[model samples]
Target chain A: MEVVIGTIAGILTSVSMIPQLIKVLKEKEVENLSWMMIAVLLTGVSLWVVYGIMREEWPIIISNAFSVMVNITLLIAYFLYKEK
Target chain B: MEVVIGTIAGILTSVSMIPQLIKVLKEKEVENLSWMMIAVLLTGVSLWVVYGIMREEWPIIISNAFSVMVNITLLIAYFLYKEK
Candidate 1:
């Protein structure tokens, strides 16, 4: 039950950026977005990954790994669009 | 060392939304913001608070508590400014 709750929470958090990512992709604009936020979030998520590894928590590791990927993608998109 | 890393991560993640919050407050606009993302994030953060409680992790609890407050404030701001 706890695992189930954690998994759901992980999925929700991991995908929370999808809408923003899609909007940025569609509009090719990031003027309203904050790169610092993304950077800090990426850093935090990375630490979560490390924490998970230390605790041997697979769910945390997996979810935050996915989150890290997502954040990196968003950061790339931000830079790419900002250059335009 | 691990605790230090986690604390810094917590601080970064907790305050990640500051820039966006400031931007929205200054502009009084949320046209580009995604409420769905905020909703999902709030849910996830709430779950993290639960998870932290279960694990007796004070950093997780405190940081996510702060995050929950920030997210809630952002949601309220979104609605208030969104109407303008």
Candidate 2:
């Protein structure tokens, strides 16, 4: 039960950016989204991946690595769509 | 070094939403922000807190609890500032 719960939580946090990505893709709007948030998140999750690697924890590595990718994509979209 | 990296990673992910919250408050703009993303993240982090409690991990508990509070505040701000 604990593992299940942890996995669900991990999955949720990892993919939490999907909705925002969809909104951005559909609306092509990024004015209200903060690149700083994504930048910070990308840094955090990337470190998480490194920590996971150090600890030999696959779940942490996989989940946070996924978050890194999602945040990076979001960051790029923010740059692409934000008003100049 | 591992603990140091992990702590910084935890801190970063925990406070990742602050910039977005600041942006929303300053601009009072949420048109491009997805409540779905925040909602999903809130649920995820809340579950993380639960997982931490079950596992008896203070770091996870404190970090995710902070995330929950920040997310709840952001949710309220989103509702307050969003145009109908």
Candidate 3:
């Protein structure tokens, strides 16, 4: 039951960003993307990692750590393709 | 310690979305926003709520539920502003 719930949570978190990812990819634009937004999200994700560590919640830690990578990649792409 | 951690977590989660929210608000555009993305995020938050309930984690439950409201508001705005 724990595994199932954790899996569901992970899926939900990972899949949630598909729209923004698709949009940025398709348009090759991120004029609307904000550095602060990305920073805050990264910070939040990092804190989640810390929270998981403090609590020893493997599910939260693993999923959020993975999410950090994905979000970082997106942010990098945002910077790379941003209108100059 | 738990309260502090939970409060930090809640703030992190809530503040994390500020960038997207600001961009959407300032641009008055959500052409890139995806319903699927919002749905997934909402689902994630909802699942988090359930997880909190199961675990009796008030912090997670309250924060996620609040996040659901904020995310729903954003999605509603996205739909409202989307080109018809």
- In terms of lDDT, which candidate is strongest? 2
For residues A1-74, what per-residue lDDT tens digits would candidate 2 score against the true structure?
A: 88888989999999999999999988998988889999999999999999999999999999998888888888
- What TM-score would each prediction reach against the true structure? 0.87, 0.96, 0.83
Candidate 1, pairs of clashing residues: none
Candidate 1, residues A8-70, lDDT tens digits: the string is 767888898888788877888887677888898999889988988888888878888988988
Superposed by TM-score, candidate 2 places the C-alpha of residue B42 at a distance from the truth, in angstroms, of 0.3
User: Candidate 1 or 3, higher DockQ?
Assistant: 1
TM-score, ranked from best to worst: 2, 1, 3
TM-score of the first chain in candidate 2 relative to the native first chain: 0.93
Candidates sorted by DockQ, best first: 2, 1, 3
Query: Tens digit of lDDT per residue, candidate 1, span B1-84?
Result: 777876776787789888788887887878767788789899988998898888887877888788899899989999998887
Candidate 2 CAPRI category:
high
Tens digits of per-residue lDDT for model 3 on A1-84? 755775797679756766777777788877756667667767777777888888998877887787788678778878878745
TM-score, chain A, candidate 3: 0.74
> Would you give me the overall lDDT of model 1?
0.84
lDDT by residue for model 2 over B31-65, one digit each (tens)? 98999999999999999999999999999999999
lDDT of model 1 at residue A82? Answer: 89
DockQ of each: 0.62, 0.88, 0.56
List per-candidate RMSD values in Å: 2.0, 1.1, 2.5
Error of 2 at A49 (Å): 0.7
